[model samples]
Target: MKIVKVFLVLSVLLSITGCSPLVNNNPTKVETSSNGSYKALLFVNGMELQSVGHTANESELVVGEFIGAVNEKVDIEIRPSDELTSNYLEEGTEIYSVEGNTKIVLAKKENGDYEVFE
Candidate 1:
């Protein structure tokens, strides 16, 4: 009986330690573009796809393979004005726009040099 109690106590301890606590049950906060400039090409499946933020205004975007190539052409538009459009950028990644003044979070990965899920 003592051995069984010890085993059960160990099992309970293991169960308690094995699980992670849940936090931040709230929805994610939306990050707004500073100066209406878009950042980071939406890299999905290893390609630069198009996306837009809701608050994005006449905001400009940089589209290129390398960071330097963005301005090799013209600025791209983040159309439709909706955060859903940019859900692909993920959260926490830093991005710069065509003019290079404003910075925003990638918030997701659409494509680019990084590997992604289909």
Candidate 2:
């Protein structure tokens, strides 16, 4: 009947509108360190990760591993190579090493951005 056709058309239109992807208007801000000479170590779920070193100009560490979920937290420590080795004190966990640089700490924000520290 005519009523059935009208209901069906409305349902289809509603479904199509509801299927649109979400848009985030307020984007998250990225944090960067001021020190030009610093080193960072990235850790995910307490496991050290091998990542490309981020310079003072770069705000975020470039990670090769795939982060499965959004807003996943990562811990970063900026310290001397010797101190890190001494503190961690674990074999085969030393992923990257930098010499003659100050250490800094970084944490992942809830919005999936790195919060840089001095």
Candidate 3:
């Protein structure tokens, strides 16, 4: 009986230790509006990250690849804007137009992560 009790206690302990807590690794997703002219994602440094429905300017930048299940190189563009549309939101993120600011960045990768620079 004692041996059976020990085994039961050991099994219970093992079960408790074997289960791992669910990990929450939800990354923040930033997206640009359908119209790039109206809404564009920008870095805190004022670099355009993603835009659509707009003419390409002379300046375009190739930034680091997006950190995700699939590694994809992201093209960050630089557009001229008169003033910032919003601030005091996410740090290290900015928008150029008063309409909206599309910004990118920030993630804690289990193995690797996307690196965004000024």
Best of the candidates, TM-score: 1
- The segments of candidate 3 whose C-alpha lies over 4 angstroms from its true place after superposition are 22-115
lDDT of each: 0.36, 0.36, 0.33
lDDT per residue (tens digit) for residues 8-108 in model 3 = 99999888767744322222333334555233333334443333322212123233333222122223222322122121112323222211212433222
Model 3: weakest 10-residue lDDT segment is 80-89
Instruction: Write candidate 2's Cα lDDT for 1-106 as tens digits.
Output: 9999999999998998788654322222112357643233343343433333433237444423322222222222332222223121132332222223224333
- What's the true lDDT of residue 50 in model 2? 31
- Clashes per prediction? 10, 3, 4
- The TM-score, computed over Cα atoms with residue i paired to residue i, of candidate 1 is 0.28
CA RMSD (A), model 3: 15.5
RMSD, each candidate, Å? 13.6, 14.9, 15.5
Off by over 4 Å in 2: 23-118
Return the number of clashes found in candidate 2: 3
TM-score per model over all chains: 0.28, 0.23, 0.22
lDDT of 1 by residue, 1-118 (tens): 9999999999998887677354323223323367775442343223344444332223333332323212122223332233223333434443333334223322222433231111
